[model samples]
Target: MDLDRASSELNEKLSAIGGTANVAVLKSVVTQASSAIPVMPLYIAMVFKKMREEGVHEGCMEQIYRMFSQRLYKADGTAPEVDDQNRLRLDDWELRDDIQQHCRDLWPQITSENLKELTDYQEYKDEFLSLFGFGIEGIDYEADVNPNVAFDVIDI
Candidate 1:
């Protein structure tokens, strides 16, 4: 997959954010979300691990807020720059030079033996399942907790 082109596109996107940008895009080769996708799981894991070490990560809400409330607005809050399709390109931050360089260095060195130590695969898997009410951290599924409750009703 055109790695150079991808890198260039990432850099171009990041540069779109002029001064006063609230978010920066960072490239990730792997994340919990991509674990199930074939052909690149190990690469993704290594990337995720590297990024975590660098303290660069953003969830869905943080990204959306930065897009409209921060990057899109001018200094005086008068206007937002948009393309012909009225879209704010937030993916640019991921292509920054430092991030790209780190990923490139890690790409060839990752292996199955060191995967667990380097990546947060198990942690991410737990978090992903917890979202759907499975494998929650504190609450025990096998506990005697009751799911049914009674509410008072009055007939008029």
Candidate 2:
């Protein structure tokens, strides 16, 4: 009934068979866009870890390019692949059975003390920061830049 017990039971069920029932429960409980279930961060971190280790991790731009080039605009002119609900399955890599199973296996072993050891929390933090243009390669964050730069406007 308590949070910890509920989380533990969910983890047990998830790890036992990687069941969709537990995933549905997680999805229902974390309905708000800005809110998440208690274990989601850890689960995502583990998923990232496994994906990176397997060399299948991709950035947002790469995913979009793949979607357009390989799926949406294929040279063969065949119809794009879609799921049962008629949505494009662009997340096929992320939803691979091996990746899901890996995350499930790591679910029960994770704890506050072993979080960094068991998951890619650091990478997650870095990626989150990159959204605001931080941690980008070849850019000098410490360099001073003129706040105002004059640019010529072209009339259409």
Best by TM-score: 2
Residue lDDT tens for model 1, 48-67:
56555666665567666776
TM-score of 2: 0.60
Lowest summed lDDT over 10 consecutive residues: which window, candidate 2? 21-30
Q: Judged by lDDT, which candidate is best? A: 2
The local distance difference test score of each candidate is 0.58, 0.66
Instruction: Pull out the clashing pairs in model 2.
Output: none
How many Å off is the CA of 21 in candidate 1?
19
After superposition, the stretches of candidate 1 with alpha carbons farther than 4 Å from their true spots are 1-35, 39-44, 78-87, 141-156
How would you encode candidate 2's per-residue C-alpha lDDT over 1-156 as one tens digit per residue? Answer: 354455557656776785311111111111233124566656667876887888877766677787778766799988666554334556677778999898878888888899899898877666656656788889999999999989999999
| TM-score (all chains, Cα) for each model | 0.54, 0.60
